[model samples]
Target chain A: MTEEIIIAGFGGQGVLSMGKILAYSGIMQDQEVSWMPSYGPEMRGGTANVTVILSDERISSPYLKIVDTAIILNQQSMDKFEESVKPGGVLIYDPNGITAHPTRTDIKIYQIEGTKLASEMGNKKIFNMIILGGYLKVKPVVKLENVIEGLKKSISERYHNLIPLNVEAITMGMNNIVPYKIEKHVFQN
Target chain B: MSELKLMKGNEALAEAAIRAGVDGYFGYPITPQTEIIEYLMTERPELRTGMVVLQAESEIAAINMVYGAASTGKKAMTSSSSPGISLKLEGISYLAGAELPAVIVNVVRGGPGLGTIQPSQADYFQSVKGGGHGDYKLYVLAPASVQEMADFVEDAFDIAFKYLAPVLILSDGLIGQMMEKVILKPQKPRMTNEELIEKNGSWATTGKKGRERNIITSLDLQSEKMEARVHRLMKKYEQMEKEDLRFEKINCDDAEYLIVAYGSSARISQKAVELARAKGIKLGLLRPITLFPFPKQALFELADQVKGILSVELNAGQMVEDVRLSVEFKVPVEHFGRTGGIIHTPEEILEALEQKIIKNGSIRHHKTRKSSIL
Candidate 1:
């Protein structure tokens, strides 16, 4: 199976890192993967995004015009990538800080309060892990054990102690995802 | 030991150089490729293999330092973007004239002069047509993947040392920055001093004590002697064309239309070929692994099979001239590209092929594109 995806959000919210984790997980499973980031000034403070492709076969182009899924975290990303998701594909996003919600009927939409949940968990750094968890709940493209293994490989040994905490956030995100029902007022938290 | 790791192109090349037992690396930092030097600094290849990594004061200094290291038949390399590469052209010419084997990497950016920090293939003419001020040719290798980025290091050095020529890895910001899974090979120890003297003793500046001091100079006061030196260099390049030329063909058995590209453009055109095949179009892709060699013979043969050809590059149609020349205008040849750092998409490339080659219904015809922004 092949999954082409784009992860977009603010620069410091770990958008590129999330894509990197997915790439590492794919490689651990003996699959081909590529992670192409928006380099230069856009990566400093502007909206940062990465296009990641994982496939059973050799991948041809790292630059992509279409994707199977778009994990959007911010409103600007929601505006930008909502149309990039293919028909019958998935678009997952956090409802927090979003002014206008995704209204596409052709693609699957799911929401998780990643920012709020991270705040409630007393560590905002796990926000991306929660989003990754939510994406895994919908697609389950990568095994959780491999994701954890990939996480260990991505971060340094100093953060090994926090693996279990990040696992908790992931599990929380996986269990808390709700399919969008077109209800606008239900997710203002 | 071998390792399977995910790395950017620049990072993989640096690690591969260390694993290849490179003697020294001298380079100035530039965007999309600073990671080459940065990774070298952070990984501390010096500790593991005694390889020296230094940040030179400028691009010119870095190249001169590379020239010095190469004079002793040591494996030395330097990397930079476009404008910085321009600064090293004089030294590159010297390396060619003196017949030194050193690796020079240009992770090309959009440019006439510092045009953009993004990936571009605009340097095709400069790379293959001798960017330096001379009649010498560099063995230019264009890597399309991070794996090739890692793998071509040894190949470049081998080719360089074999012919006593300079080898250039003509990469772009795209490959330099993108991350992919690459299988790194096992480390090989560097050639010992005795081995170097034995292999390159006749030409290399080994020492003055043993034999009549081997004079190394590109300049000969006698015009006839200079002519002989140039002819000798020319024969080596011709040998490279006969022995080391490389290219790849994809889905060409029944192809009626062909796309010729290299580097990042090759990867993108591969995708476009697949997309067109899905729609029942018989399109194939020809990727030149070596830019300097040009793959002219392969293109000449393919020209007979395919009805038309499209040359897709990242610049304003530079390789198009070479493509037309290779085919001798036997079939229609067109160019589709986006300049100033904007990568042309597969859809646009396919559209160009249809409009310029197939739909136009001519063996050779020209029509100026009405819209340039698509």
Candidate 2:
């Protein structure tokens, strides 16, 4: 199955990094993945967003207007991406940041207080990790252990000690999910 | 020995140049191509092989420096993107006219003017069909990945020295910016001064001792002499066509449809081939490793077998003309192109193949058809 995702927020909210983590995780799993960032002036302290495609098959283009999943961490991101989610898609939203509601009725929206969870975890910067945790709970495209290992590998040596804290956040987030198996549709002839 | 390392295309090009025994590297800093010069600077100090790496003040100075270094019978190279490459055309034309051996790289970006710093294959016509004035040709190699980036540099230099002509490595920003695993083979050392003076010292400005001082000039005062020079260069190109043609054929034997592409477009076309194969369509790709040689004979042989050919490119049908020239009227050749420095997707290429080559829809007929062949 093709997994297309968009992780968008204001600059410095770790949107691009989140997308990179997902892309790297996909690559580690031996799947074809491409991470493309928005070009033009949006790259300079502006609204930074990244589109990531992870597929079992070869990816044609690294672009998509209708994403299967969207993780919105900020109000601007929620406002921008609310309309782009495909029918029967999944959206992970930050209730503490986004005030607007999704327009589509076919999507399953999961609103979380990411800011509160980050504060409780003793670091506000780990909010993106929390989002990833929630995303993995629903979709579980990659193993949680692989995502944490990728996170540790991507960071500097000085931050290597923080792996346990990140794992704690992922474990806490996963514990909150009530496991449900959705029938995944495959486009096969 | 081959060593595999993670490198961007620009870095791989620089490392390849060093491994290919390039005597000198002259270039200016341009986005996407900056790493080439950076790689030279980082690697130049530790080099026991005695190579010269200089960052010129501007693109013009860089190309002219290449011209000077090449005139000295030393293997010299330069690199830039589209705009910077445009600035080097005057020097390129001079090098081609003088029949000098140099390796030039154009890490292509969006263009016409100061286009965005993104990947683009818009300079296909300017590169393959002689970017300079008069009649000349460059040995062009389009590389899709960082692996090809390192591999093509050696091939380009070999072709340049064999014919005493300029060779160009045509890559794009995507290849330049993206990182991939590269396996670089152990490089042979540079030629000795005595050996260079012996081989190319005939026309190269070495020294005027017992032998006459040969002036390295492209200017021929008499019209017949200049015309004769052009014909000689043409003959060298024809010889290259017969001897130095390089291409990669993928499952083309008895295929119903064929896809013709190069560089990054060729990589995407490979994915299209896999996708089409899964759908039970017999598809193949002809990736031209040497753009100047065009692989005309191979394409002609395939034309008799396949029903049609789809020319896929990142620009608006520049290489399509070359494919049409090769096949002539034997099979219908159509084009699937994208302009404005945008890359075409494999799905888009597959769709084009399904609609044009498979369904047999008549696209724009090229006027240059049969003008070169039949």
Candidate 3:
């Protein structure tokens, strides 16, 4: 099985790092994976996105036209990626900066209060981890144990002390994500 | 077995260079490839392996430093992106003319000028056809994966020393920036002065101790002498063409159409091949690993079997020329590409194949082929 996902948001929101950690987790699980980022000037304070693919077999292209999941963290990302997600795939987003919510009926949509939860936990940097937690709770592509091990590898030794707090944020996100229901009658009409 | 670690292609290349016993590295920082030097500096290979790492003031200075170190028969390398590599062309020409063994890496980006910082295969003509002035050739290797990026450094050095010519690791920004698992090789010890003398005693200037002084220069003013030297260089290149051409052929046994690409383009074409096959189109992919000693024979043989060929690239149409030349009109060959750093997707390539090549039904004509060949 292969899971091709795009995680996009503002530059400082740890979008790239979150994908990196997930890719590392895939490696720890003895799976083939690839992490490709949209580099250059777009990564500087603008919208940044990464394509992360985890597969049981070798990954063909690191770039994809359509993905299994779209983890949108901002309104621009939502507007850009809503149509790119495969039908029946998942779209996870943080309701913080998004005014225009995803209105697609063919796919499942879920929202996590990532920014609010992170701010409430006294650390805004854990926002990405919270979203990641919500993703894992919905898909369960990788185990939580491997995610912690991945965190240990991606985070430096000096920042190891913050692992517990990040884990707490993830747990809270996994429990708090709410399903985004679209009225079927309106779409059918 | 070496342990597998997830690393960016640039970082893997840096680590592999150290483990491959590179005696020195001199490079100027360039985007997409800057991580190579950054990782080397952070690792501080000098402390562990006695290797020297220096950031030159400019790309010109960097390639010249590589030339200097290589003159002493040391394993040396320099890396930069397309624009920065343009600055080192003069030094590259000098190294090729002098027959010095060195590794030069170009993590290419879009360009005819200082184009976008996005990935591109536009350097194919420049790298494989010799960017610098002179009738010279550098063995060019295009790596598609982070693993190959790490593995090819050692291979490039080995081939460079064996042929006494410069070897280029021609990669692009996508491969340089992507992260994947790599199995690093065991560290090899740097050669001592005595070992260097023993290996390159005839050509290298190793202190000239109790022997005739060895001189290295590419400036033979005598017309006949220079012609003779050019013949010798051409002979070496011919040998490489015969013996060192490397490529991979996927799903070609019963394939009706062939897609040719290298480096990142090849990776994407592989997906296109699969997509076409799923649609029952009987498509396959042929990836040339060595761009210079280009697997021309393999392509020619495949062309005989396949109904048509499509050359997909990240440039306007560079490698397509080589593909056309290799097929020699035995089959219809078409080109599909995206320029200015925009990478084409598999779906796009597949669409192009269906619209341009497959549906066209082999528009066989000798007139255009004759004109192109001439």
DockQ of each: 0.79, 0.18, 0.86
Give all TM-scores, in the order shown: 0.96, 0.79, 0.97
Worst 10 residues of 1 chain B by lDDT: B363-372
Chain B TM-score of every predicted model: 0.96, 0.93, 0.97
Q: What Cα-based lDDT does every candidate model obtain? A: 0.91, 0.81, 0.92
DockQ score, prediction 1: 0.79
Per-residue alpha-carbon lDDT of model 3 for B54-153, expressed as tens digits? 9999999999999999999999999999999999999999999999999999999999899989999999989989899999998999999999999999
Worst ten in a row by lDDT for model 3 chain B: B361-370
**Docking quality tier of candidate 1?**
medium
Q: Which stretches of candidate 2 lie over 4 Å from their true place?
A: A1-42, A47-189, B38-52, B187-203, B207-214, B360-374
Task: Give the Cα error of residue B321 in candidate 1, in Å.
Answer: 1.1
lDDT of 2 by residue, B1-374 (tens): 78855456788888888887888899999876788999889887336567888989999999999999999888999999999999999999999999898999999988789987777888999998899898999988888777789998888888888888999999987777655556798987898888988988888887777799978878998999999999999999999888888899987875889999888788778878977999999999999988888999899999889888999888777888989999976888888977775667677889999998787533322333645455
The candidate that achieves the highest lDDT relative to the unseen native structure: 3
lDDT leaderboard ranking:
3, 1, 2
Docking class of 3: high
